[model samples]
Target: MSEVNISELNDSQVIGWLNRGGLKASADGEIGLWNEAESALGALSAAQVRTGVSSGNSLQLQARDVDGTSWTSFLTLTAGNTPTCAIDRTVIGATTPAAATFTTINGKTPSAFGLSLWDAADAAAARSTLGVNKHYMSLSQSSGSAIGDGDTRYVTEAILTTAEGYATRLYPMHTGTITRVIVQTSCQAVNGSNETATVYLRKNASSDTTLSSSVQFNSARQVYDVTGLNVSVSSGDYFTFKVAFPTYATNPTGVLMRIDVEITY
Candidate 1:
């Protein structure tokens, strides 16, 4: 028979002998044998447990979930100076992290602007809201008077002068509904005679389709609403504005025109 005296050993030696004999000792001198059945009995409950290391200026106790996928700090103990614990939510892998709720972001209340959530897919792309409403305006000017003898001329280009006017094509930034359109023009006749003018909004190469009825110009500045006159335009679709003056005259020189379009997605 093998015999060992526990009173003849130090604390570590006694612990080793007891471990070899399938016995465990708690901090308070309680000795017991642990088995699979004992493990299923209950779990150890404690708010704080020593890590068996010397206490430093700061210490943090972290624990991982049962799946061992994520780790979270549970307790922090400090001795000298109080250390700050900063929790950062940054994904180190390619997959995005779980979503979190926040009242304010970057010091601005998201709910104030009706912003509720943001879905971040990756580091490069993120989505906040859906469609947006936008407005655009283009202006063109001509120096000399072109005879308006019932001929269609692109209003965006200066036909009678060498000056290059604004772009003749309007490209929408997004595919949406064209809500409104307004055309404003300022023209004068050199002979001081009243001239009739017709403005047409053309899409693509279909110039026969009139967006609006012929607007009569009385040799003065005027604004006309062409919302109901023009057809709906898609994203990247080009728009052409044409002006026709059947009665050519020298008085309608130095024409200034502006076109405004509104789109909603």
Candidate 2:
């Protein structure tokens, strides 16, 4: 019928065209089908038809033909080398630090029972006393209280006041040798009399007494100090200091008084 080259034949047609589905070639030298012995045919492989199921290009691997223990060598194909992408180099900063804020209030109340200094209505000018040692003191009256060794009570009505003068008790209750003293005072004034006061260090109604200091004032608030005055106060002892206006001086400018006394041993 028609003459056709075997190489140009379709795959299915070539298979059927061969007698017994095989070919007769000269030797296993070129790319031609060979028909040696059945064992020799086993060394040759059929051409594999691979189909790609995904959208990517197809990839092929090197294959060999094997006999009992030997194989036909295969040539390497340099076709599919995957390409690499570049990476960017950079230094990114971290998040900023948070700011600080205040959380609570810190405050304190004023000291009520310590040495106090205030002006009186009778003094011609301000008076200050320094270094007057304290022995012991307390506010036992219904209206006032005192601060003493080993005593820790802070309350109002621990101080006494009047137009003429004020009174509180003191005792030297300490552990070591008694050294110096501090005194605080406040007073109410009466008319025409210069604001005057007498601070005392005494044991009782009939005992040893010392006039450590005094003050004179002409107004509502005043402060006075008696310093370097030799007076003694110790631990676990009682002493009293009375702030009084000179009596028999008729209608002296009277005022309420406050006293803060401190002693060191």
Off by over 4 Å in 1: 1-132, 142-144, 157-167, 188-192, 207-211, 248-251
> What does the lDDT come to for candidate 2?
0.36
Please provide, for model 1 over 1-265, each residue's C-alpha lDDT reduced to its tens digit, 9 standing for 90 to 100: 2555533433322222322333334444434333333321111224332221223434444566568787666555444343344343354335545676777778876763344325534322322243334546564555435454565666654433222234566777766656677777665544324656666666775644454554545456778776644356776677767766666444355566666877654
TM-score, per-candidate, Cα-based: 0.43, 0.32
What local lDDT does model 1 show for residue 110?
A: 76
Give residue 218's error in model 2 in angstroms: 3.2
lDDT of each: 0.52, 0.36
Worst 10 residues of 2 by lDDT: 147-156
How well does candidate 1 score on lDDT at residue 142?
Answer: 57
Q: Model 2: per-residue lDDT, tens digit, 68-89?
A: 4543323211222442222221
